[model samples]
Target: MGDLTLHGSVSPDSLKEVDQFDGQEMSAAEKARLEQIVWRKLDRWVLPIATIFYLLSFLDRSNIANARVAGMQTSLKMSNYQYSIALTMTYVPYIAAEFPSNLLLKYVGPRWMLPTMVTIWGLVATMQGVVKTYSGLLACRFFLGLMEGGLFPGLVLYLSFFYPRERLQIRVATFFASASLSGAFSGLLAAAITNIDGKGGRPGWAWIFILEGIFTFLFGFTCFFILPNSPATATFFSTKERHYVLARLKEDGAVSSDDKSDNFSWIEVLRCFKSLHVLMLTPVLFVLGVTLYGLAYFEPTIVAGLGYTGNKAQLMSAPPFVVAFVVSMITAVIADRYNCRGFMIIFFTFCNVVGFAMFYAAKSNHVRYGSLFLTITGCYCSAPPAITWVTNNSAPHVRRATSVAIAFIMTNAGGILATWLMGSLSPAPNYTKATLTNLIMSIASCVLACVNLAYLWRQNRLKAERRQLMTQADEPEGMGDESAWFVYKL
Candidate 1:
């Protein structure tokens, strides 16, 4: 009776006797109950507020593509290449700003920092609507990137505070999928807003910026009241439930305290350079980012290639994004459920490769449009898992932050490069070169996935052999040297 009683009780005395602390024997029922508590934590606050925050941020940042076709380019008298430069400008500060911002997020608390950044970016996005000259537009784009830079990588780190490693990929995927919706929704929203061109002597593109920015500002205010700072500071749960979560998280080797340390330095920055994992991950992310950003940078041009009118082209862009949004979510769920990030990534990249190849080969508009759906779907599908794979392998909180920052910076750099490469020269009917480049990038990404897998397998084998040797010897307690012994997953 005493042993049976331990199974259901949460008393300190009972908890101490329940089982080993490895998290290996948590029965399905216990896990289900814990998950219910976690869900309650999520549905009550996390998902709703995060969705609104990220959705608005993403929409405001990316909606410029939609706004350009609506009227911004014409109103500002910018050429196709110049508009591409404007799009590329936003990523410049974004690439430079994420690491420092994440450090601030850790110190100042996300509740204040995230909301403040959102409001600032919201104001900047609104200001973008008012820009009359090329220089004004450039200034606004740079500032917009500066403000929105840390939100995503910071969000990933923030989410780790709430979820275990196994579950984080799905949640991150879900958060990122919000960006996909921005793509899908921005088209529809721009379609409606573009009709307001003559209403107040303002262009339809200005209205796109104004309306989306207002929505973003409002969401930011809401986030101030709703976003939880961390598990340590969370107030929604009862004290015992918080303790339960913190203790369980510790059992899983996910406690963030292990990574916290003194101020950053060039030495810490150089640490990432020494890791083979970062070496392997950077190129994969670079190519993936190039392909994804190429698609984003050129979506409007691609849609217009179908020989549609302006508004219809804006509206037609919606379907491919909608397809990508759905496919990405499904891929994330499957990858997280089975812990199969590497293989799933390879599969999705293969799909992207084939999709891009089809776009390059197809001659007819209908065939090209069909390929757009496939290309967007498959390329977007691979991103979540590929990113999650990187995150899952990185360790220690500070090191993980450095690793993700490196990947994100490279990705943003890719965005900058793709913006130029897919410029006016490749517009419609002759975008075959751009499409072929995307196909090659996708194929290269698949090869990296295989290389990563093989490396991880070799590392795992080494780890197992070391563990066996240690067990066979008589070593003192607490003799595990993390530097020599701990090997990260691929």
Candidate 2:
């Protein structure tokens, strides 16, 4: 219950001593009580803000699809190819900005960085309503992507600083489930907002952007005052609670040497790139991104193709995502409780394969609609674990930041590819070719997940063997998953 002294900087050596003290001195019940207090505070203050931020981020990014159905494409005089290019443009800057933004988040701190970025993107999202030309729309979309890119990976990295690997999956799933809920909310909101189709001489599509953007901007500004940067700086916690937070994290092997350092290291960046797990896992995420983004961007349109149009199609889009949110949270809890991330990932991916295949081959509209539910459930459930896997394995703040960024960049690359792929499914009434392509991607993702699972199992076995030989003192301080005593959550 003693406080670790605070200073201008916390050295690795100091953190090591703190880690040792917390591990050896604290009794089991005392430790558990302190941990409960820390978790309750975090659940109250941190998780809700991060979840809401991401929900808005996704709503702003994907609301364009709803806008398109409300006649933005025709209003802007954009052809299918032009509209696709606008979507592609968003990913270009989005993919590029992720790594640098994550790095920046470390230096600037989440309190300032997250809300600032959200505000910028919110303004940009609002500007979409004013775009008179296709070029204007493209410009707005690109800027929106650039600003929004950092939030997801940044939140993931930020959450890592708070939670250990085993507990991280459920928290991440909760945040991700917000993204799914955003999809449902966006649909319902768009359906309602589009009802103001001709008010104030503006189309309903324009109104969608205007209203949602205003909501985002205000929320972002408010978050600047509310969100805490880290456990050390969080004002809501008592001194003892803050000490407990740091102690528990250190004992859980969550903190790292570079965590408090402002200096960026190229060596850490190179180390992330060289990791075999990261290299293999990036492609799996990439494929998932393709299907995920493609579906998010076009689910309304797809539902419209199934004989529902306008407001009804928008309303229909909500149910699939609602189902996805429920399924994702359930799967996340199971994955975390059982420590079975890889198996769960593979299982969900296989579900996607089945769903997509049915969507492609089924002759009945009801069957295809049911297939949407399956596909969304599978994709949404798998994503939290997939991203958490990278964060769970990568050591130190720098490597985790770089690895998460790289994974997202590659994944967003799939999104860039999806814009074109989904676009090519044009002549819109029936997207036979697009459905087949997504089916193929889902199958590929399942194959890769199986391969990755095998690799993780092997890695865990090796680590277990190594752990048997090493004494507790042999474990490296703040090395996270790379520590001799650390076991991969497989």
Candidate 3:
């Protein structure tokens, strides 16, 4: 057949039109097989490594919850308010560091920046173990936040360099699913580690931080060797294969060729701040962060209150994350397969609405426990699509980096709120204030999703209608995403 589509989306006409001077043309079947080979290579080398780093990132941050249940609060003599203060400390630097971090990520690139951030945060996480005083613990949390802040938005931008728009959600989801897996793994691992109480002059909660942090710290160095800076420099690919990868991205409108230019400027950062879409996205991202950190930093406590205790509560926490991981992957598969992003996001947010509602009102332990699954599923599934939506749409590498960073600030703000949500203040079981706040945030997120989708849909229509007059006549490398030719994946 003369007709062939890559990932069932890219067609021959657009491919040829965009890259008319491509080295050669092949039959549909030949092209399809080549793409499969390339994607497999990328998935093998890229996905797992990214997933690994993110898993550690999450584990180190959330393990504080595990520590709390294992007597961390008592050891440090922290009040609920004091504990909340420490939890909130991490996010302030985390949000503050994002803008500069985005600029640095662009200047240095992920190959170097990502591993460096991980290593520092990993060290900070390990320090969390050795903290003897409340002030000492607070300092560790603050620096940990500072170091870890950049990696997430950096990872989102990094993936865009390799994957096209149609294929982005699945790839983003695959690694983003690491958050859920990390949740599961953290609970299981914490149970085992915390059992070794009073080992080597350290409490059980201390080990939870020490061991996990050390592993994460060491793993960061390996990423420096493994991660390719960009498709252009990926050592695993032949020159020909590299060309094909770059061409595919350009043809798919995943990026403008000029996007690779090293023209990072303050103007680009300003544009991100000025972007209405990006601004609107901040509130949604804020809520997204709320749901995720709400569950993550507090789930162990939530489980402890649900008639489960000690290792049993930790064990119980794992299952919901496991389920969430599965739901996240499945949702991603469906979203990517249908080439639908916004609607899928809307659906996922609404799922969270139901989850938070049930979690707030349910009285039975079984019912309450079951609601955990819904909450995790909704939070984990929604993130990849949301990040993918922003990353896949923004153009000129600088703008994407800046937009994601801008939006991510709200996520850290949400983390700040989540730190105080339940904790010692609201207690456990019912957790009235926390539940009510989460419920309200979920409903707000749903509304924001609708608003974002409508805006995207309208933009898509306008772009489509004026398609005839669109041209890249102004800038040499292309006008970035501002070019009318750019297509939103909504």
Question: Least lDDT summed over 10 consecutive residues: which range in candidate 1?
Answer: 1-10
Between candidates 1 and 2, the TM-score winner = 2
> What TM value does model 2 have?
0.92
TM-score of each: 0.89, 0.92, 0.93
Q: Residue 323 CA error for candidate 1 (Å)? A: 1.5
How well does candidate 3 match the true structure, expressed as C-alpha RMSD?
4.4
Ranking by TM-score: 3, 2, 1
lDDT of 1 by residue, 1-490 (tens): 0000000001233233223234445566765676588657855667666666777877888788887778678788999889778978899899889888865666677889889989889999998888889889999999999999888777776776667667777777777777777778888899999888867767888999988898788778777887887766678876545656666555444452322232444554566677666677687788777777777757876788778768898888888889888877787777778788888778878888888888888778888888878777776777777667766665545556677788888777878778776776466655866777778888888898888888876876776677677542343322111222344443
Error of model 2, residue 145, in angstroms: 0.8
Estimate candidate 1's alpha-carbon lDDT, on a 0 to 1 scale: 0.72
lDDT of 1 at 42: 59
Q: Per-residue CA lDDT of candidate 2, range 6-105, in tens?
A: 1121233544443334346656676577778888889899999999999999999999999999899888888888878999999988988899998877
* C-alpha RMSD of candidate 1: 5.8
